[model samples]
Structures are given as structure tokens and as C-alpha cells.
Target: MPDRHVTRSGDDYAEALSQLLPQGQAWPRDEGSTLMRVVRGLSQIWGVVEASASKLLEVESDPRITLDLLPDWERNWGLPDPYYQEPLTIGDRQKALVQRMTIEGAQSREFFIGVAAQIGYTITITEYRPFMVGLDRCGDNRVYGDGTNLMYSDTFVRGWLPVYDPQGNPVALDEISEWPNYGLGPDTNRHYWTVHVGTSRLTWFRCGGGGGQTGVDPHLRIGLATDLECLLNRWKPAHTQIIFDYSGLTNGGSMAGTP
Candidate 1:
């Protein structure tokens, strides 16, 4: 009932345990509470607290691994499309794009097209310049081959997390604060997250865009980006993977219950 009483009771129990321990027992032998166990407990709590968070934060493993299936792609399926491609060259460039999915059936008719719409999208650009190279290293007085190889990336992610009000209206529906961050390089920068309302899912895209060289602040173009994300969400009309990438052990170890 009263929070103070509950807290006091917990404290008293802790005190009793403290007294029962020998003069200095090394704090419960935390070797029994290794980092792996902590991760297991965290994973469990995450599942309990979010309930549905598991779909996005799941882990899997397989003993039959092979060279053909070395790097997994299934985990980051919800990530933005551009990240899947090769790293952008210093001078090379590509147009930025966004898309959205609008739900229209009876159950999703209201929120999907209404309040949930208020949450905006984000577009971000990151220009990882080359370290620099000397003239001879530039190439054997080579033909205009690609300039210094650099890690140029751009990303678009949801700036504000989405939420819908009781009256069926989107509160903060149109803002892309920063670029979505998946990972880097080939499997370098890959990250993704999702918000779910029943069976319908709002997937945000993220990746390095090739626009960093030009000094563009993607958030300023939120209006255009929102339009694109909305389109991607609504009518792609294609079968697509819903998860990004997967990593972890399959056998389900016992050390997953520590913290």
C-alpha cells in the first residue's frame, strides 16, 4: 500500500542479509553474476517491461553456420534502404529518399491516418572525410581513378518517437531530427527500431546518405522526408523482410539469469 512501508521492508530484509554474511564474503560471489548473466537478466527485463520489445530485440544462433551465410542480413530489415549498399565514394553521390506506410483498414483507419501521423521522420547526413594521402599514393599518375577512399555516409531516422493522443490526433507528427543510424561500412553502420500498435508496425529507416559532402542538414527537409516515409509505409506492394540482422547463440545457455 504505502510506498515508504514497502521500501522500509525491503531495506530491513537487505540489512538482515548483510548481518548474516561472514565479516567479508566478497559481496555474494558475483563470479556467479558475470557480465553474461547480467545481459541475460537485462534481456529478460526488457521482454517483461516492453512486452512487445522482443520482436525487435531478439537473438538467435545456429551451429550449422557456413561461409555462404557468414554475415547475417535478416536482423536489420527494418533499417533504411541506402545502408545496404556499398559505401559512398568521396565524389560519388545519390539522391536522398523517404517513404511512408499509411494504414487504412477499419482497426487502423483512425490512428494510422490520424494522431499517429503526427510523429515526424528524420534525415541525417554524416561526412567521414578521408585521412588524406600524398601525391604518389594518389595512383601511378593514374587516369582519373576514384579519389581518396573515404567513409562518406548519410542517415535518416525518426527524430521524435511517435505517439497518438486519445482524441485520435497526432501530437508531434512531422519532424526528422537526425539521420537514422544503423551501422557503418559493409555491415558497418546498421541500426533500426520499431514502434508497434497492435499488428501494424511503424518502421523507421536509417543509413548514411551521400549528401554529407554538400553540407545538407536533413532535418530542414523534414517536410519532404515525411512525405516519402509516409509513402513507403503505405503502399510498397512488395514482399519485404521485416527484421534487420540477427546475432547470438542458438542453444540457449544457462548463464542467462544473473542480474
Candidate 2:
């Protein structure tokens, strides 16, 4: 067991006094005695220093539970960026701080996948490239910039968000809601890419879950991964166009996110 740092009390002092001297009859060590009263008074004063030292030594050390030193840490790291709006929770602040401190800067697809995992989503990235002749397979349905056989994610407005059930209760669906890969086009279109996430977030309601009826858990539904999309937009390269998509169907099939 860990040691208690409360320091010596009157009982401890009295016991030590008896041990240090020859077997004593005068030192009855009773609480009512004058000698015992003096010992108790001294223990209180001594306890103040011990308690202070104990608290000092225990100063919040881990960032996971770090409360007292959070402000100092945030200021030093130049955090609370405009990318994230206010009314943020302490857990959110801590996560951003730790991410800022440890994440490696990269523009790779795998890197973005790792970033999604940090925010509680498992996702896949699709990179587009301009089509070519001879080098490309015949009848491969490559884009010629005419818009045929090519699809792109225009997520200018995400209308598929499940903010309410059919009954209009405030709720989010629990589903895959993943989008299909935005087909590539012209050379400039190569900058357009897509991320397909595998899960959606939903808060448990007292009445049950997000399903409008039957009280079904909807564990296999494909909903939205809003946070993953937001974070990716904030970090994607200046030249790249990111398309966030999730399956609209519960069968794990892709949805045509474009108009």
C-alpha cells in the first residue's frame, strides 16, 4: 500500500516517548494529561507542513488528468485555434493539445486515416488522377473531362445528416453512411479526393435510440461521421479538394454523394 503522508500525531509522539525512555509510570500518556495536550498541539502545527509538502509533491503530473496546469500548457503551445469554436469541453482541449504536441505533419493518405482514428473514426482515402490513353486499359471508363463516367463529391451542403427521425425527435442515426469514391476527371480534377468513413455518432436517448420506431438499436446502420470530415477539411492541403462521404444505405453500399 502507498504511504500516507499525514505525518506524526499525538499518539505517535506519545508512543515514541515511551519507547525512548526507561519504563515510565509518570508518563501515563492519557489524553487528559498535560503532557498529552502539549503533544497534540505540536502535532497540529507539524501536520500543516507535511500536508503542504504532500500536495506539492503530487502536483497534477499527467496531461490526461491535468487540470491545474492546463492553462499554462495551452498558452505555451499556442492552442485553442480558431479551427475549433468555443464552448469546448476540457476533454476536447486536452485532446487537441496532445495532438498538437505529438502528431507528425504529413500529407499521405495513411496519415489522414491515422488522424481520423484519433477522433474515433476508421476511414479510407481515395486519390484521383487524370486518365490517359495507351497507358490506361481499354474500356476502363476513364474520364475525358466531358463529365461522362466521372463523379465528384461536391459536399458544399451535406443534406444527408440525420439530425431528426421521421417523427421529428432530435436524434442522429447509427449507421455506416459512407460515400462512394468520387470519380476522377481532368488533370486539375486530380486534386479532388474522397474519404469514406465507417461509422456515425449517436447519443443514447432515455426513451431508446435514434430509430423512429420499434426501439431497434440500429447498430448496423450507416450514418455520418461529421467530426472526421471537419478535421480533414481543416488539415487538407491548400490545393486539394476533399469530399467527405458515408454510406446512406445500411447494407454497407456507397451513396452517390454528388447532386
Candidate 3:
């Protein structure tokens, strides 16, 4: 037997309609001409609409297109990617800075200070350092140095001792000189014997001068707690702000207040 074809085209629809007509009957050449034109026009219009809808659906389904899913503050506000161009205005730079800092969990001093206070430590903003960048650089051309000098300085915290053992009796300097320094180099030899007390320091910096201008340099530095546990325990959410309430959809009530 001949194989049966499952798919049909527009010609197949015409042939099937011909079979439905009476014997020797036929449609006029111009029959339903206006209706055909209307349908053809409608098909063309629908094609454009369908293509646009498909593009929108494609964008909506993509996980990387997250602007629509973000809150107003977190969204890009239709701005182009800041990394692609040098921010010319203060607002543009601020937006870029906030976006980056939010991602880094260093958005504000409050966040760092709050976390530090929780762990019996205090943060102090104490020093500033400035550096020069060439004119060809991009973005905020002038970047301030973080207060690493103070953080690494021995005078910042004094309770810590530079002895090998805090509880043991003090050893003579002559005795320490005779003892084997092991694998420690001369620069780190003194540090090898130090006992770290419950004191640490963190330094943070802000980018300060830009706008396509020359000779405009600014500087600022801030301190943060360097306690490993406190720093690690800081409030660093994956999202900078809340935009959705998933609980309302799944639990039949808003989860606005309850922790």
C-alpha cells in the first residue's frame, strides 16, 4: 500500500475543500476576494505581533534579565552599563558606586560599624591617602587609599604583646637572639613571636575624584572592625533591597514583620 502523508499544506486545504463541493461545482475566481484580502492583511499584522511577543517572552524568560525583577532602587533606571563608559555626572557615579558597594556588602558605614559593635569592637575613621592617575584612565580616575597603614600599625592596638608566650615569664632579649629563628625571614622574625590579643582593624576607602576634570583630587579613609567573626557575620544579603514577597503567594499572608 502507498504510504500515507500526515502533514498538509495550504494546497491540501484547497483540495480538501474541493472534495466537499458538489460534483462539477467550483468557486468563482473572485469569490470572497474582499474577505481574502482582509485575512491576508490580518495574517501579516499577526505575524508582526507574534514576532514582537516572542521577543518579549524570550527576554522575560531569561534569568539574566533581572532589572524587571528588582526594586526601584536596585534597578538600573534604564541607564547603560557604567563599566562601558566613564560616568560624567555625580549621579551617574553615585549609581555605579552604590550598585558595586551593594554587591560587595560595603554599601554604608552603618553596616560595618553595626557588625563590629556586635562583637565587642569599635571602628574609627582615622586616616586618608591619595594617589594620582593618568588622564587616559576610565571611570573614577582618582581613587583614595584604604587606611591599611593604621590597620597594620603596631600602635593601633596595644594590649597585644610581641612575646612568644603571653602567660610565660618574660624572656631576656639575649636569650631570644640565641634561639633558632626557624624558617622565618628577618622581616617577619619579630612577628613570629607576637601573640595576637582580641584586637584587630579594618580599613575602607572611597573613590573620590573624577568628572573628566584635571587636578581635582579628593581623599577619605574609614576604619572597620577586623574581628574575623564580626566581619564574617556582617549583614550581606545577595540583594540590596527587597522587591518581592514570596510568602503571600505560598502561605496566604504577608511576611512583612515576622522574622
Candidate 4:
């Protein structure tokens, strides 16, 4: 037998309901057909319910919260205001110094090395002034601490010189005043070792001229070695990364789900 097809419309549903009821009676008749009227009423009710649900979601997800709404004591409960937090500790200050120094490039390397020395650590020098080992006769004839003639007056100096005894054994120089031409030599062979003791004091050493002339040995100097080792142990450079989330909660409540 061939399959029979049925149309699916509001009238078809009404007719089907009518057939289910007693033969003489029909579904409650009304204007614009009972089925359409019921469907329209349900749609209107659903619209009101949907609007109410959307309003509830809006209330829950609201993100407007200000400190003025709460008492002073209550404001400290969650996230404390950055301005009102405790002052940074020494470690924090040191870390900040390292971060800033790293950004300043070569000029700040001495400062970094000083800090590392204090902490009992050392860093390899990748770049430095080529004529750092010589006198005031490199690229610019003017030398550091030579009044106002130097081009890069801000740069630090590190040089070495040898001391020779009139006899045979090497000996330290009695006084710096003995050498009038010290630091004024045009050749790289006449420089002397100088150790900086803190920012203000510099101690110059005139070693016995015997072995190959070289840079100052930081470890051999008692004062410099002790100070630098102390600093290295005190402020070892292990920096920690920090991240902050600026997105705050809604009216002091838990974070709300998406609407």
C-alpha cells in the first residue's frame, strides 16, 4: 500500500485534537483559533521570562566597584591599594637596581660588577674600552681624572704598571709623589694598578717589576676581596618574575560566569 502524508500546521493540530474529543463537541472555540491563541500566549509568557533571566544575568556580571563604597578598614580585605602597601624591602630595592642597571648598557657594567663583587660573584666582560690598560694616549689624548680634557670622563679606568728595584729583587714604590710622570705616560707599558675602595677612596699599588705586567688581581687585594665577597654573598642575583592581574571582582563578590 502507498504511504499516506499529513500536513503539520496549527489547523491540522486543532483538527486532530477535535477528533480526539466527543463527536458533537469541539475544542473550546475562540477568536483567531484556540491553537494559535494558546501558542501566542505561551510565546508572550516566554518573552517575559527571557527578559527577566537576562536582567538577572546583567546584575550578576556588573563590574563597577569603588573603594568609596566601603569603609576604610574594609578596603584592605581583598587587594590592597598599591600606593598604600608597605615600603619595598632591601632585597626588592637591590633587584630593582639590577633591573635598571641591565637596561643602561656598558656604562652601568662597573656598577653591576661592584654589586656582583659584593655578593662574592663575578661576571665576564664582553666589551670594554680598548685602551683601558694604557695611559692617556689611546683614541683621545685626554685621560680620565685629567681635569676637563677627557672625551669620556664618566668612564672608569683600570691599568697596570711595574716597579723595578735598583738592586735585583722587586719592591713596592715608597710614594706616588716619586713618580711625576705616572699615568701621563704615552705608552701602554707604564700603567699602574689602582683599587677602588668604595665610591670615594682609591688605593694605588706599585708592584715589583718581575713577572709579565698585567691587570690588578682583585682576589690578592685584602680590602677589595673582603668587601666584594661580602657583597656577593649578601645580594646574590637570583631574580624572580612577578605578574599582577588588574581585573577586579564584581561588587566584592566572587568572579561571575559568562552571561
Which candidate model has the greater TM-score, 2 or 4? 2
Candidate 2 segments exceeding 4 Å error: 1-59, 85-89, 137-184, 202-227, 248-259
* Candidate 3 C-alpha lDDT tens digits along 1-259: 3323244344444444544545532333233655434444444654565555554455333323322332333343433332332222332333333433443456354664444444334332111112223312223322222323211212112333233212122333322211212231343233222111223322222233212123332222122222222233334333322111111122211111111
The residue-by-residue lDDT of candidate 1 on 1-259, one tens digit each, is: 2112112233344444445546544445242445334434444543344433332233112212111221242222232344333332111211111111223433223343342333332211122222123311232211221222321222121232322221212323331122222222333122222222211122222224222223432221111223234433543224321121112112221110111
The lDDT leader among the candidates is: 2
Query: What global local distance difference test value does model 2 have?
Result: 0.52
Ranking by lDDT: 2, 4, 3, 1
RMSD (Å) per prediction: 25.3, 13.3, 22.2, 26.5
lDDT of each: 0.27, 0.52, 0.31, 0.31
Off by over 4 Å in 4: 1-180, 183-186, 190-193, 198-259
Candidate 1: stretches off by over 4 Å: 1-75, 82-107, 114-118, 121-219, 225-259
lDDT of 4 by residue, 1-259 (tens): 3223332444445444544554432545454766546754544554565555554444222212111222232333332224322322222223333433343333233764655443333332222122435533434332223222212222223333332221111333331111213333344323222222222111223233211113532212222233333333333333311111112212221111111
Report the alpha-carbon TM-score of model 1 versus the true structure: 0.17
Per-candidate TM-score against the hidden true structure: 0.17, 0.51, 0.22, 0.16
On TM-score, the candidate that comes out on top is: 2
Error of 2 at 66 (Å): 0.9
| Candidate 2 local lDDT, 59-119, one digit each (tens) | 4344544555767778887776655432234554566678778877689988898997775
Span of 10 residues, lowest total lDDT, candidate 2 = 203-212
